[model samples]
Target chain A: MHNRNAWAIAPLMALSLAACSGEADKSADGAPPAPTNQTLAEVIADKGEMDTLEGVIRNAGLSDVLAGKGPYTVFAPADAALGAAGSDLSDEAMKAQGAALLRAHIVPGALTRADILAALERGGTGGVQMRTMADGLLTFSRDGDAVTVTAADGATARLTGDETVAANGVVQPVDGLLVKAE
Target chain B: MKRLIPLTSVLVLALCASSPALAQNGNGNGHGKGHGAGNPVQQDRDDDGDDDRREGRRNGNGRENRAERDVPRNHRSAEVRVREIVGDPPREGERAVRELRRGLERGESVVGREVIGPRRDEVRALLQGCPPGLAKKDNGCLPPGQARKIDRSQSYDRYNYLWRSFGGDGGYQYRDGYLYRTAPDGGLLGYLPVLGGILSTGNVWPTQYTYQQPPQYYSRYYGLNDRYQYRYSDGVLYGVDPKTQAIAQVAALLTGQQIDVGQRMPAGYDVYNIPYDYRDQYVDSADRHYRYSDGYVYQVDPTTRLVQAVIQLLT
Candidate 1:
């Protein structure tokens, strides 16, 4: 999919959302109670590590978008990363800059850890450069199962936890902030 | 003495053309005091009593003498210096000087790949923000922005990246082995010592990229010192210390990607000088507060004890 123009894919987003709900409802004949249909926001809130991420998404006004539907692959940074950012996000100026940076972490379509690895494998040199929802660049490199991502601002974040599947999207916890270059 | 005047003049011209240091001493220019006082021609003429012959020779050589006198002493070898510094093949020094003169006169950058002249110290000082008296004139030096443009051109040629231009948020460009900043137009920004590079003084760690190269070449080229040429993996030119291999300039590339706004700045970036217009933009939370000092606003996160941002209070 040409995800580079993700912002223009509003119709696709709605379609993907409907498709997701259909998949959730058709759980294979009583398979593990069909799993709770939680959105990415609910999954993050439930996980307890993404309090800052949850706050940022809310502040950036992307909570509704993330909750609405469609599969997004969010390399979400945990609370510690947010705290380390200090006043930048907690302060007022973050209204615009924070939104852009947050968008850089969220990809339009769900990218599983396996999918990331496969992309890296296909791009054998250092890694594959992916387009973020913020219209920025994210380079992904893999050494075995250890996946590391570099943002346009040169901030590197490594996948630290297993993926969390939500009704709307997937959340992969990262160790650092995914900052976009200004 | 009259017969010997032509031979003496040729010798004097040769010496002035070859040695820049000697030309500066007022060699044959009759300002013959101090270092220039030791010229053998003057001493020989003093030794022989030939006043009548000397007067005749002076009248005959007057046109040649006038032509020689018209040439500026310090600028005689400027052409040779330019060619030698850029490693260009030998050419007419006069033509090279004329080329430099024409470019400067037209406010165009001299096209010797930014090695404008042999006046390394003067040029280095000018680039370091110390504009010498001579550089203040348009005839002597390039207009401020054009010099920077030329320097940026050289920087692009070397690194294969358009480093941030002068005055916009400011970024680093490696040129002639020194890690330079786009500031103080036409000045040497910073010398990278072959060691740890510039130390991070604030909360942010300076982003550094060290080029990986063959160890054998490093040892061979930089035999006397620990310094090795560093270049970005994709850079066109590898950087050896412009100053010298000994006490090498540091090996690092400034990605110039430091984010100055918002929370969660990358590890290497910290807010720099927020403007007064932006002061009201930052709302103090329970955990953090903004502090105003010396016409600058600073965001202090008490827990980290780091100034999150340095905001300039724009009037």
Candidate 2:
């Protein structure tokens, strides 16, 4: 859907691998089943609540770019939202705005949370913008079923978890790091 | 500083052009950026005469479209290119290129309407692994033994790439005035913020259809954001947010359809960077550069080659 152009596999990870398979691998266009060949940079380096956003995406070298094949959608950030936004991550965020602050929390493609709630229900708007590979932008929106995002200075963030699903991309995890340190 | 072109009849309604898809090609022109005092473009209906028609070819029977090879005629107005490229205040680039031409003419009137129930079967299940217009209109991908043939000897306007007179892999520097994009081993990479300088590829920038190269997951370079306005076609590049005229795409280059995130992309052809091992298994990293087409590959931007990212890889 141009989350920049997905398809390393992300139909919301076949509805999150069919709600983690309780739905018996839901497919037949119910979408949702296959995930876990691992590599959204190895499920965010096997998340421990994403150890400081996985050491700032491997010190922002981008860990061979999320383990290759651009599946992307990331958003990450939850080390208690970078230690509750004290977010300096030391050394002036390790300069180069710390890899543009981890490329704003990566977005390129592979989005999920049901593709940001079907892109905020087919874009009525308030959120769904995206952008990121460091050019920044962010927006998202949808809330009840969970999703939040924001930025471009409104600085929001919400999204919680239950959406890692890999093979190529989809991460979600947030709480706040939409940005604001320097 | 004045009439920067508005001798109006709504710009003589910019010569009554129309192209539901070529009715004798229809002239059109007038988006205007002007160089030698604009408004003369009317090329289709060709007498041929070996003029080479800027190199996207199809010279003879009058087929010069890229909206009249990007209206090079002295037309002027974005309050005269923001009072000549950024002195600014031309009623804010004429109310942001007239609301990005009414939101890209209302998203190009729903791009070939004919939806048919259930969202046309979910846009035909997202055009599955090809067919139903395979490679769409030659922006790339055809060689499944030439899938019913239509190659254009490496296509053009909708871009197929490889031409610095065929040695074409990369070149163009100009710097500071901004034109940049070098990379094919030569390096340089991002620059083209645009204001002009390569005045002699001789005629159409990179010899017409603007040289082609856009896919690096496109974003940034809206002239490094000063509220955004930059526009161009075929050779990609677009940003326009001037009070929500909303288009942001910034470069597209190719599409057989089915791109979603913010949507847009699909103006037909013009996208590049098709070499680095040609599709090198759809990319692993070097930041960006992938091109393919129709069955989808795209990615681009190895430092602003342009596109930002897009993937479908035929399934």
Q: What share of the true interface contacts does each candidate keep?
A: 0.00, 0.00
Model 1 regions more than 4 Å off = A1-36, A180-182, B1-315
- Candidate 2 residue runs with Cα over 4 Å from true position: A1-72, A79-81, A86-99, A102-104, A111-132, A135-169, A172-182, B1-315
Cα deviation of B106, candidate 2, in Å: 46
Q: Is the docking of candidate 2 incorrect, acceptable, medium or high quality?
A: incorrect
- Candidate 1 per-residue lDDT, tens place, B1-315, comes to 111012133323332243221111111111112211132211111112222121111223334433245545532322211101111221443443343334333433112111101121211221333122213222223344445446444423432122221123335544322334544354434322111112111111112322223112122222223443332221111234524422232221112121121222233112121222232344345445443322223344434433333332212
Local distance difference test scores for all models: 0.39, 0.38
Q: List chain B TM-scores, each candidate.
A: 0.17, 0.18
Supply the DockQ value of model 1. Answer: 0.01
Positional deviation of residue A148's Cα in model 2 after best superposition, in angstroms: 26
For A1-182, candidate 1 gives per-residue lDDT tens digits of 56767767888998778757745433343221222378777887777778777776665445655664334567888888766442444433233334445656766444556556654654576676654544456777875667888876687889876576566456778988776223
Candidate 2: fraction of native contacts reproduced: 0.00
* lDDT for A19 (candidate 1): 54
**Tens-digit lDDT string for candidate 2 (B112-202):** 2110011111211111222222232222223344553333222211111111111224653322122333556755433322211222111
User: Model 1 reaches what TM-score against the true structure?
Assistant: 0.31
